[model samples]
Target: MKQIFTFLILGLGVCSGVQAQVDAVQKLDAVILSDSKLKNYAAGIKIEKLTDSVLSNNATSLTNLLAFNSNIYFKENGAGMVSSPSFRGTTASQTAVIWNGININSQLNGQTDFNTVNTSNYSSIDIRSGGGSVQYGSGSIGGSIHLNNDLKFSNHAETRIKTGYGSFNSKNLGINSSFGSEAWTANIGVDYVDSDNDYKYLGTDSVNENGEFHNLNMNVNLGVFISDKDILKLYHQSYIGERNFSGTLVGPSRSKYEDENFRSMLEWSRIIGKFSSRLKVVHLHEMFKYFENKDKDNYSLGKVNTLLINHSFNVSFNEKLQFKTILEYSNSKGNGDSFKEPVRNVFSTTALLNHKPNNSISYGVNLRQDFTTGGERPFVFSVDAGFDLFEHYQIQINGSKNYRIPTFNDLYWQPGGNLDLVPESSYQIDLGQNFNYPNFNVKLNGYYINTEDMIQWQPNSTGLWSPINIGEVASYGAEVEVKSHYNINEHQFNVSGHYSYTVSEDLETNKQLIYVPFHKGNLALAYNYKAVTVFYQHMFNGDVFTTADNLEGRFTSLNGYDVGNIGCNYTFFKNTKNELETGITLKNIFNEVYENVAFRPMPNRNFNIQINYKF
Candidate 1:
């Protein structure tokens, strides 16, 4: 703890310097896609934007990038197997993942596995904290994560290639290229990663057996200017991966899982006078096969297909008032060995109004309603306001109602499926304050959420587990973030950090939720001197209870841990036409022994080297 404080003090006490400009590596010319809605309509929401430099530094996987940079907590079966997130103390299913303005959560499980997503494939990533059901739809009770691609229209062309070799025989390869003209634009990215993942378990002679895995991701985006007032865009993404589940300390097992995902969307936009409109057609497909034995051909298979149509219109009444409306329809079909085939159809409508009465005050109102064939639907609404209290201080507040419907596996599974389950509903409120200066920025936020009829799978009288409407739950938390950058001559320094305190309790038992930590934080520091850059990052996770009863035994809870990483990079052969850069990262420099999940030990100290070339 003392060392951590000393490091922070050193970063603050250095010679004062002028504020640094935005990194030259950022693609400032690109136009943001779906996130424009959030920026325009969500006046009081808290949004975090991951910069291009951060994305390039942690290009291996989304799990690695978020765990060190965001306030969300993650639990991994092992180093790179079956990772899930707990945002603001909410369950994994309560967090929504959006891709290209569409909700892409699994229809079978209602959640996304973070390990399967590659960070290098997307042009931008944004994290929105607080309930977002009014604009983003279901499974957004806690928060939402957005992955987007940007479109550029200019006479520009570039290509980048990167390769890396890491510990445990891990390898990474990535290629990205983009070209833009007066009439059209194209961007494509491909990434492949694999590992033998056989690290030795700390404090034990056993090794992480059967943990090898590999994944491939490909993304392509195209845009065409149809006319002076019309534009068309197309996006497609594919992901395929296979992994062997790691064995726990208690036993060894041979099991494998294979999955594939494909997504495509086409959109058209037009503007005339004060009115603008957009229409989108989307298709998504996901499939998975699980093998209990590595050598066996027999496996349980699941597949789902979804099609959606969405249209939205926006009109500006004046410079201070705006109105927007959206209508959407979706149909999904699921078939699997564990559950009977099922089909679901849903239709929804949303209305939004924004008013900026003056320069110091702004507010927005959003309302949505849904009708579904599977079960009853809920009406959700959100209200937000922002106030510029002074020159350097601002206050914001927001409240919303959110909901999540039951998944296919919850209602159609062979023996234990229950058809009577209802959607889970939640109400939440957030208060925030911000301080911005020339060189430093700070933000503080507090939030509370109450959920009714929470869904949980539990054993019944016949010892068969089935989904049921659990009681109520209450979750509250506070977050703090600080960032600053300074430049003196050719030397530059950047510092950023965030801390979260959370408490989630079950109304009946009055106990903390399992895997929900009470405190978590991380800090990052970087120094850039001409062609060389050095960086360090540290993360701290408080103890977490693994059991619902909040037991104190070693097998029931995990101890707190602190981990640090350091790296440096150098740029050479830099010129107007080409550039080459090489870097090395040492992860877990202190060799901290920790486990995200009980009985599942993480890897020890490791290192990786990467080289990148651009033209």
Candidate 2:
């Protein structure tokens, strides 16, 4: 506790220092993604942006980056294993993942594995909290994560290469290159990662064997400016991964997983008078294979393919009133050993209106409807308002309706498939406030979500599992964040912290939900002098119940744990067009023993060193 206070005091001193000598430090232009409807219409939404420096610190995977800095909780089975995120006390399937303006959640399970996404492949990441189904489509009852790739036209060519080594025989290598002119731009990036993951188990002498994985990723982007009124952009990404799944201490040890993912998107934008229009086409394919043992004959294969076409138009009437309309068409097909061959078609439309009477106040309203040939049809809507009360203080209120459709596994499983399950729906409300200053920013938000007719797989009297829409849940949470940064002479200091409290319950049984923590907190501080920098971060997760009934005298309760990490970076060389940097990170400084998921132990203290060069 004393260390935390001292840290805050040091940051406060920097924030209170004189600003006359701060002209030497320049802030980079933040990449503000325009794909979010909330960002364009509302003023005080709960949105967070991860900058380039932060991304560089944790470039291995998106799971590692978000688990430490964000309020979302990630459940991991083991090192280099499958990982998923739970947002705002909602289940994993309720959160949506959008890549380059298209939904990329798996058609089989309705969720994306964060461990499979490489953070180094994208230039920008944005997280928008609260329900966003009105604009982003279904499966957004909690929030949405948006990943973007950019192609900027510049006169100079640049190249970057990095290599790193860590504990458990882990290796990382990456390369990125970009060069373009005013009329055309292009970017290419590639990354490779492999790990043995043979760490020792806590309180035991036995080592976790057969826990190895390898991953490769590639991304390409091109942009063309066809006159001043029109532009076109194309993007492609591919991923290949193979991993050995480590079962429990007493379970099988030879299971393996292999997967391949490919995505392509093309977007065209035009401007005419006060109207702006954009058209996008996307295609995605995923292939997965599972092996029960080392035997080549014992395996299963699954495949899913999806295509999307979307069009959007925005018109501004003067500066106080604006209107936007969007249309989306999608088709999906899947085939697997346990699933029946299924095809689905969907069409959705949305209309939104924004009103800003003055600079201090703003409001927005939107209505959306979705039509599906093989699924439930529903209507969604949202309303939000914001008011600037003072020079740096603001208040915001939002309400929305959201829903999620059953996945392919839930509807088309071979043994107990149920094609009559309807969609799960929810109503959400959010209230928030913000305080912003040159060197300080603070935000507080509270949200309540009431869900009805949730789909769940339950065994009948005959012991056949089937998905049924017979569950209700009520989830509410509060989030608070504070950040400060200052540049004093040649030294810079930054501090950021957040805390969240959530309570999720089963409406019928009045019991807490499983795997949802009640309290979570994070703190981070960084200092930079000249070309050298140092940082430290700490995270805390509260106790969680692993069973829905909250029964005691069982092994279904998980105790909370604390984790701390410290790192330092230094510039080795710098020139007109060349630079080199070296960094080292020490994670789990305390060597804490804990499990995020039942019976899945995490790694202990480990260190990694990285070297990067750019020319």
Candidate 3:
């Protein structure tokens, strides 16, 4: 027995040493990749991957791995071009989201709407919580989300096609393919969905009139590995969709909109003798059209076309300290009659330093400067520290000062919109801790944020939603999560859960911020035996308040609800040359009727089936 124990310990040591060597040679901060690159290295990544299943629908429309861990609240406005996510007490434009290391917010004027993205095209999706100003500029006040295509499976030439039908007359069709050699890879994907969401309405004679949505998405990637340490990638993605706006009017007219977003990325990375370099050029164009009534009258341009250019560099001079620098320049233009602004430009630079004096502790500091040709913007700065105690315990401390300028809609929006709006300034602090044992992981994060000059469109007695620079608002939040993975022979079990509570109040006036949830939680469990896997989940949303006034086109209703999902998977030929996986998903398993979004009531129980064949 003593000899066996000693041998096991020695084997573990050898494995650990090999893993450490592999980690040391890789870039620690950022990686340039397409979907093919992502899939080939998914398991070893620090990020998470949320999927509906193999070649099928995900939990919803978005892969949205961030939904599992971040403190962000967003409801899909499926019927319109504008999708908003509320972070802390800030608006949708405050948060930043990226794709393949590109700043999407800069190109879209600070909104990464989820309604249009097809989750099936992505290999990985991740969100970095709180103040990524060091690596990205502008819309990083709340946090940053990064997503990319998967490339690992591109080594072989394969094609996948999936189609499904469900409640509300929803239809979906998707196809994806990848081909590659030892030195080059290519991937292509196309997906389309059309849904007439005429679910059972509550207390109203008319069925929810305008809840129809149609979506189309495409993604393609080509890459070449020039050498062991040099790589170049070209990626293109686009989403074109039309949504039936949720907010309704008493007349026959229903809110509707069309959105087209397209992006191309050219990225190159090369490593030379203890130093590495990266460069990326991004081109994006978007068109947003909103119309009321079937005649397509009352057309309004929600978002105009825009372009962005971004770059970054990172170097590890020695073992103790590393350096990173980033720059971004963006130009925006609005055409069509609804918008008056011609064009705008913004640029920023940020520098960051990460130092680890010892193995147990590390500190990071970052400073940023920004320039906008049209407006006077404030500089952004932040600092963060991470401490590892006793190998399995960690603590992170962070603080940051951030600012946001008025969007085009907020500036010249006429009538209900404010023109003379100043940029909102905010300061925030966060404390986070996590502990991992051989079988379990526990994580907790507590944070506080204060904002002055919050911008909101509060209606006067006249019932108009007018932009107002409100007084300071304070918010404090806490989240706790735990996960465990256990294995016995060929049987396995996984369990995870998280809970978060948040509140925002006016500092002087003592009023609650609008439409911000105070509580959220998710629970998941999976059991595996032989070739079969069973998984179950429960997602809960706490109460949030919005305007009860019927006159307001936005925020006419809000509430809280809980939903559950159950799934099972079967793997055939698990150990053979042909591998196959099949699974099913049941959303809203309890048939609970709830509404987290106004006019956009929750969908009833839905079912999905998925299959995957591995080469």
Highest TM-score: which candidate? Answer: 1
Cα deviation of 553, candidate 1, in Å: 1.0
What's model 3's overall lDDT?
0.66
Q: Residue-wise lDDT of candidate 1 within 1-615, one digit each (tens)? A: 433533432332221111112112222223536545777898899888998878877877898888888899999999999999999999999999999889999999899999998988888899999999988898998899999888888888999999999999999999999999867899999999999999989899888999999999999999987776667899999999999999999999799999999999999876565566678999999999999998999999999999999877776668899877777889999989998589999987777889999999999998888888969978899999989989999998999999999999888887888899999999999999999898899999999999998888889999999999999999999999888999999999999898999999999999999999999999999999999999998999999999897998898899989999999999997887799999999999999999989999999999999999999
Candidate 2 has a TM-score of 0.93
Better of 2 and 3 by TM-score: 2
State each model's CA lDDT, in order: 0.88, 0.83, 0.66
Compose the digit string of candidate 3's lDDT tens values, residues 466-539: 77787887888887778888999999998877787887777875655656778877787889899988888777
Least accurate stretch of 10 residues (summed lDDT) in model 2? 23-32
lDDT winner: 1
Ranking by TM-score: 1, 2, 3
Encode model 2's per-residue lDDT on 285-345: one tens digit a residue.
9989999885566788888898998877776667898877787888998989989578889
